[model samples]
Target chain A: MSPYDLLPRFKAQYDANNQEFSISGVVRPQAIDELGPSIALLRDAIGRVRGVLYVNVRRLTQMNNAAFHAFSRIIIDACRARPDLKFVVITSSVVGWTSRKFGRLSGIEPNITVEEYDSEFYPGQGFLEEGGFVPILRSQTKMTWRHERAILPRHGMRQGIVMADICCGIGDFAVLVQKEFQPSRIVALDHSISSLNYARQVMREFDIRGIEYTYGDASEMLLDEAQFDLVTCRHSLQIFNRPELILKELYRICKPGGRVYITNEKNSHCLGEPRAESIRWTYNEVAKLFGHFEMDVELGPKSRRYLMEAGFEDIRVETFMVTNLDGDPQDFADVIAAWADVYAGEMATRRGDGAEFVARFRQGFQDHIFAALHPKGYAGWPIWVASGRRPQ
Target chain B: MGPVQHDLAGEPTFEPMIQIDMEIKGFVSAWRHCDYVSTYMARMISQNRSDSVRHSNLFSSAFNELLEVAFRTRHADGELACRVSRHGATDRIELTFPCVPEERQFYEEAVSQVAGTEARERYLNSVSGDLAPSREIVLLELAVDYNATLRVEEADGDVIRLVVDLPLEGLQH
Candidate 1:
C-alpha cells in the first residue's frame, strides 16, 4: 500500500539526491493527517544524512491552516535539533486564488525558510526566513534611486502636458513623474483596484491632488482620442499579453511631438556575484510561467524594435547600468529571495517538475546570499529606457 | 441589494438604500430634449453612493435605454415614478409608469415577446453599426439576463412596471 493511500491523487517522494523532497497534488488536511507522521520521521532523519532538505510544496492543490501548521511544526522542530541543517519550504500560489496566500511559515530558527512566490516577478533581493520577509519594495522618499532617475532630468515635464501612465504599478513612478516633472494633468489607469488603493494611499501621503485615477484596460482606454500630451509606463510594458494592441493604442493617444516613455529590463545583472546569479536563475524560471500574456519575454530585450514596429518615429533607446551597494548584502539577498518566491507557486501548476524546480532554485538563492556577503560581493543591474515621439 | 464596496480615500461609502427617493415626474420630463430628470436619475444610479464602480457603470447603461423606451411608447405621459432600491444587497432599478391606458398592451407584448438567440443576434447585427440601437434589440438584449423585465401589473388603473435587476455576477469587472 502506498503511503499516500488516503490521498490517492497526491504523491510524496524523494529526489535523486535526497537534498530535495517533493509533496504534490490535492494536499487536504485529511491527506496530511495520513501522511504527516511519516513526513515528520523523514524530517527528523533528514538532518543526519543531508545538510539540507528542500521541501517543495509548490504543487499542493489545497492546504488548510491546521495542516499547514502541523507540517510547519514538523520542519521547525526537526531543524531545531540540527542547527547546521536547513529546511526550505517553496510554495506556488497558482494552484488557485486561495492557494499560496498562506501566512508566513518557518522553523523555530531564523535560517529556516518559507517562501511564497508571486507570479509577477517584480524586482527584489533575497530573503532570510527568520523575519518572514516583510520588506517594503516601494518607497516614495527613495524613489529617485532606481531606474527612473536615469530618465527624469532630460524631459521638460512642463505645466501643460496631459500625461497617462498605463500599469502604473503602485503609482511609485507616477508619483515621481507628477512631483519631479510636474505635468499639467495625469490620468493613471490600472486593472487591479488593490494596487490602485495602495497608490491612492501613497498620493495622500504626498498630499498631492489633480490626478484622475480610474480602473481601465490599457489597450482599450476609455478616454478620447489623442487627448494625452505624453504616455508613460515604467517596468510594466513587458507584462502585457497584447503589447501590439496596447502599443498602437499608446501611439493613437499621444499628441504630436509628445513622447511615449517606457522602461523595463532587457538585462538584469547582479555584478556576476554568485548570489545575484542564483536569484536571476530562479527569477528566469519563475517568470516563464505567468508573466507573458500571449507575447514573448523577448519583447523586453527588443523593445526598441517593438517601438519601431509600433510605428513610432524618432525612437531612442538608452541603457543605464545602475550600480549601487548601499544596502546590506543580506538585505539584498532578502529582497531577491522575496522576488524569487513571487512566481514559484504560480508556476508550479504549469510544469510537471514545477515544485521540484522551485525548491532547487531557491536553494541556489540561499547559496547566493552566503556567497554575496563575501569580500568580493558586487552587482550591476540594467534598465532599458526606451522612448519614441509621435510625429509632429 | 447593491454590492458593498469600499470608497476612495476621503470619499464616503454608499448606504444600502439611498436616503432620498427620486421621482421622474413625466415621461416628457425625461425625454423632453436632454433635461434634468434623465440626468438626475443617471447620476443617482451611476454615482451610487455604494462606490461599486462596475455595478454603477453597467446598471446605468441598461437603465438609460430602458428609460428611453418608457417615453417613446405612445401612452407615455410625462408622469413617471422611479425608485432605485436594493433587494437584500441586490442592486435593482425599479420604474413605474402611469402610461396611457390604451397602449398598455403594446408595452406588455414588447416585454412578453423576447427575441431568441438568433433573432437577438440579428437584431444586434442590424443596429450595431450606427449609434442607433432599435427598441426591439435593446429589449431583447436586456432580456438575455432574464433579470431585466417589463410587466403590466394592472392595479387601480393600468400601470406598467419596468424592473431592471442587474446581477452582480454578470457585472464582470
Candidate 2:
C-alpha cells in the first residue's frame, strides 16, 4: 500500500472520538487548535478503549517548542489517566526531526510509541513552517529524484572512496546516500554546528555508521588534498558568495575520474534582473574554472541547465511537476509565518511597514508558488535538474 | 570485561560501564553548556581520554593534564586566571585581568569601536557625575601586571589592540 493510504484511516479513527482527548502530533499547533474540541473528545474516548491510541498527524510544516510541549503534555495526561492504554504517534519526516531528541521523546512514556516517516509522505511538513524560507528547489520530489537517479547508482558499485557532501543542510542526502549505497566512508560537511550536531544525532538514532560529520566552512575545510570518488552538492550552491572559488575547491578534492554533481533550482523570478545578474556571474565563474578540467556542460531554463553549466558529462535534465491538493489558505499562511521569522532581522532594518510588506509578499508569493500546483491557479513552477560526469 | 575491579579507595578502577558513562555524561554536558568556558574545558579534557591505563585520580589528574596542555599550547597566554571560590553548594569562578596604561587605552579604543557614537554618548552621560578633570593624569598608577601581552598599534590616532598567541598546554587532560 502507498504510504498515504493510512491517512483516511487516521482521519476516521480521530473523528470517532467523543471525550476529552489529547492529540500528540508533529509540526502543527494551528491545525490542532482548529480541531481541538474533537481531538479532546477523541482522547476521552480513547481513554476508555483500554486499547492502544494511535494518532497519525500529517502535513505539519512547522511548530514551536511551546506547542510541542503542550502536545507532549496531552499525551502524558492521557497515559496517566489510562495506564492500560498505549499511545502511538506517527510523524511525517519532512523537516528532518528523526534525531536523538525525537527518539528520546518517542520513548518518553513506556506505553507510548513514536515513529517518524520520511519526506515521501510528509512533504513540506516541519516545525519551521511559517517563518523560514523552504528553498523552492529542495522539494521532496526533487531530492528523491536526485538520489534515485544519480547518488545511489554511483555509490552502489562498491567504491572504496568516500563521498563528500558540502554545505549539507540537515545532512539528508548524506544520510540517505550512506544508508542506500553503503559507501566506504561518507563525510557530511556543513558550516552550521547546530546542523552538524543534528546530523550526528540522526545518524546515531538511525544506527547509521561509517559517516564522519564536520562543521566548518566548506572552502576552508576542503583545503585537504584527500580526493573523493564523488562530490555531490544539492540546493546549497546558490547561497555561496563565491561559487567559482568553491567549484575550484570541489575540483581540487575530487580524484581523477571522479565526478562533481551540482544541482540548483532555477526560476524566472530568481533569474530576473539583479538576481539574473548574480546567476550569470556564478555561471561565468564556474565555466571559466571548470574549463581547465575534462568537463561537460548542460543548460536549461530549469534544473537541467543549472547542472549542465557546472560541467557534468552525459547531461540529462528532467522537470518534475508536483501538485498538492492540500495547498489551502492555511498552508499559505503557514509559509508566510515561517518566512517572516527568517527575514525578521533583515526586514526590521528596512524602511516602511515591514510587517505589512512581508505579510503581503508572503501571501502573493504563496499564491504564485501554489498557482502552478493548483488547477485553478497558475501552473506549478518547473523544477529543472541536470547531471554530468567528469571525463577520466 | 573482566571482574570490574575497584581501587583500594573503593573507586571503580577498571569499570568500563562507569568509564563509558562518565565519558557519555561529559559529552552530553559539553553539548548542554556549550556556551560556557568551564563546560568547554571539561569537554576538551574528556576528549583526551585514550585507551591507555594511567595511575591518577580522575579530577586532579584531568586538571593537571589540562594545565600541562594549556602551558604548552598557544592558548595559554589568553588563559584567564580563573579563581574558583566555593560558597556552600555553589561555586563562583572569578576572572580578573590586570590593565596597564597602554592596555587600558587599547581597551578604551576597543570599547569605543564596539559601542559606536550613540552608545558612547549614552555611557558618558550615565557616568558624568563621576568624571574628574585630572583623573587621567596618572599613567604608572594605572599600569597592571598580567601574564598575557597586550599588543597595541597606533592607527590614525586610534589604538588597535591585538591579543598575543596563547600556549595551549592546560588542555592536555
Scored by TM-score, the top model is 1
Top-lDDT candidate index: 1
Candidate 2, residues A5-36, lDDT tens digits: the string is: 23321222354453223233222222246345
TM, every model = 0.50, 0.38
Task: Give one digit per residue, the lDDT tens place, for model 1 in A1-392.
Answer: 43434336557776646677777653333224566654665564574456678777655543332344455556656666677777776664322212222223331356567664433323221111113332334531142245465465443245657898876656666776777667877877765555666777767787776565655556545444577877887665666655777788788888888888776664333333656556567545545544432324334567788789988888878776543354455555555455455435433434455557778766655655555466676544466778888887
Model 1 bad stretches (over 4 Å): A1-146, A153-156, A182-184, A197-208, A267-270, A274-298, A326-331, A343-350, A354-360, A367-376, B1-60, B70-173
User: Model 2: residues >4 Å from true position, as ranges?
Assistant: A1-161, A269-360, A369-381, A384-392, B1-173
lDDT at position A140, candidate 2: 47
Candidate 1: residue B108 lDDT (0-100): 64
TM-score of chain B of each: 0.62, 0.19
DockQ category of candidate 2: incorrect
> What are the Cα lDDT values of the candidates?
0.54, 0.40
